[model samples]
Target chain A: MSQKRKLLVHIDALYRSALYLTKNENSADDLVQETYLKAFKSLQDDKEIRNVKAWLFRILMNTFINKYRKDKREPSLVDFDSVEAFHESIQEEVVAPSILDGESVLETLVDDDIKMALKALPDDFRMVILLSTVEGFSYKEISKIVNCPVGTVMSRIYRGRKMLKEKLAGYAQKYGFK
Target chain B: MNCNDVRKYLYAFLDDELDVEKNIEVLGHSNICCGCGRRMEKERLLQKRVRETVCEVKAPAYLEQMILKRTEEKPNFFISVVKKLMSERRLVSLAGIAAAIIMTVYFFAIPGNLKKDDFLYLAESKYHDYMMMPQLDLDIRSQDQEVIVEYLRKQTNSSIVLPEIRDNAKLIGAAMSEINGVKVSQVFYMHDGTPVSLMIICKPDSGSEDSKNVDFSGMKEILVDEKVVYYDDKGFCGHCKIMGWKEFGNEYVVVSKLNSDEMIKILKKA
Candidate 1:
């Protein structure tokens, strides 16, 4: 397949992520365009990209951070030690035997509700959650994409999901599922 | 693995990132422990819901084609050689040969003219007519006037001053375009939900023949900041009113559907 044809397979994925990142259609379109253009240009340098999807995502993310989000306040960084401590603390929470009762609440909540909950997350957590839960990127892949350690990725994903669940808690309660 | 151990690695296990031994231990523990099992199930459900919700966003139909067209191979050396032959006075005989060949295939091969009005029409069509340009894209997108002006200045090798408009107008972005075969900068803004485009072109050398033809014959000239600013209330195109001025060796043209007074107010504020 041609380079462009090969790269085209990931456009939908990239576009979806760009939309979540930008929250505007035109900006998302521009972001994806820049990503693909940069990807194609880099491919000319004969760099072999082992995982094209992850590679494209990394470019999309870097472009977004450097160009689009330059003026926006950056998400505060969490130190590795603090994240590890937080993970340890979360594990000590009483394991509710009835957590499964909330499983059906996810079904009751529509796509928009889930989207709003996701958007409510901080940029750092939201990015990791999207990469891990939605795109199914490995913690290591996400670490490389976000330029952080694997431990940070793991912590962010855990915290991101926790935040998402908290945001949806009211909806879950509305449906009497939790 | 005990419940506490499994809980610590719960997300990693659910994400399938745990090592084989730990993965097997977590699976075994979750199967036997009811609470751990429920927590795993809840995590799985959350992941599924998040994925399904976000997967609904698909690229618009035109996006792929736009990407492909934008990355299409630019003019190669042969076209550059022909362009050079056309430009250099010393290559007059060669230019004659190239022009003849160009004319024969011009209808099908050459892109649209790189003239000043062509660029203006492009800006007008994109903002007003909602058209797309295969080649044109913003080099920088920012609401900050300073950022947009700085970026355009670098691209055009000329300083750019963004006009101040009333009613809290915001800068959208800026792009570099060719005007009269010279690189010029175009800045886009939005006011009351309407788009305004400002095209900045450096004035040609003082004695150049092109400078003599800079005509605003039908446009009404007015003084703003002691500059001879020109305005056309009856738009140059059917839908767009145009205001222009020359300062600091650059010609600035502001185009929009905005009335002459509003456009002039913006220029005066600059």
Candidate 2:
């Protein structure tokens, strides 16, 4: 495929992720524009990128992180030890999954409810969920884009999904869904 | 697989990330365990809901077009030229030499017959030379505008009015110089410790060859107080903004490394 054609194909995905990251339409537009510009300029270097979509996502995430989160430390890959510890804690709790039997409740939730739940997520968790669930990136691909380890990616996905279910549970009950 | 094992691989199973053997084991366990199966279904439903909601946001119709337009607009000309030159190193170097020789011949051979406005080019060159020479000194080294103006007036034998730029700049000195055999008065000022030079000479008559050669072609023009002033877009002398305007039957030119906005402010004040 032509370079531009390949790149432009992912604009919708990039824009959606940008909106999730920025939470403002104008800033999302700016972020996506900057991401494309950076990607195009780097393409001139003639480096062969194996996965252009992942590469573009990497650029978008880097731009968003650098431009907006300059003051904060970068979210690194979840350490293996931490992931193990987190998993152990969850196993110990054995808390009943709030989302069990909530399938019909989830179905009742509209797009706006889902968006509000996603937006309510913390930045770190939201990024992973958006990449995995929304854009369908693999844990390995998410690792590369978010510059974290696969273990960290899995942990974020688990926690992020758990958080989403809890938030949706409130909406599910309010909407009269058993 | 027991409930603990099912719980451990539940997320990986939903994500389709488990190995074939592990995937079958998880499926088997979930089938026998109603609770684990229900939990897996809930997670699947949640993922579907989130994906469907997020997917509702397609890029606005204009976003792709805007991005493509931006890419089209930002052509890296210098990089492309460099790439081409690198690929054709031998031929490009030979062509470069020939082009340089042709330009040199064109400049030197046509100077004698060149029109008066051509003198502006010569004046710009002279301006560069004087500005570069460290030994060249002003005739009057005074901060007082009156002293510098009086000195330049007597030296050039022309009526001179020193511009008021006291708020931001101070007078450095004044001098007399000749450009294309025409006497010119030069005043210098210091703005934030940087030197700016202003050159003044009689406005050439409509039919004069000097006036014809002085029109700076290709420079941008803007009217300040109804007087047309021309300034070089890429900066003229030593990266200084050179602005010229004709006022009171005299042509005034100011050259400084100060930015265009500041230069305009000083010129408008003048």
Q: Write the per-residue lDDT of candidate 2 for residues B1-270, one digit (tens) a residue.
A: 998878767778888889999999999988989988887777787788788888889889888788889888844899888667767856778788989998887555533233223333333333333333322266678887667656655555444565556467767776666655555555666665445666555432233222322222222333556666554343211123345533332343333322234443544332
TM-score leader: 1
Note the residue pairs that clash in candidate 2. B116-B213, B117-B212, B117-B213, B117-B214, B118-B213
**TM-score (chain A only) for the predictions, listed in order:** 0.86, 0.86
Let me know the DockQ for model 1. Answer: 0.19
Tell me candidate 1's fraction of native contacts, as a decimal between 0 and 1: 0.47
For each prediction in turn, the share of the native Cα contacts (below 8 Å between chains A and B) that it retains comes to: 0.47, 0.40
Q: For every model shown, what is its TM-score relative to the native structure?
A: 0.54, 0.53
- Model 2 residue A18 distance off true place after TM-score fit, in angstroms: 0.6
lDDT of each: 0.66, 0.65
Model 1 bad stretches (over 4 Å): A75-85, A88-92, A95-103, A176-178, B73-270
What is the clash count for each candidate, in the order shown? 0, 5
TM-score of model 2 vs. true structure: 0.53
User: What is residue A66's positional error in candidate 1, in angstroms?
Assistant: 0.8
**Where is model 1 chain B poorest over a 10-residue stretch in terms of lDDT?**
B127-136
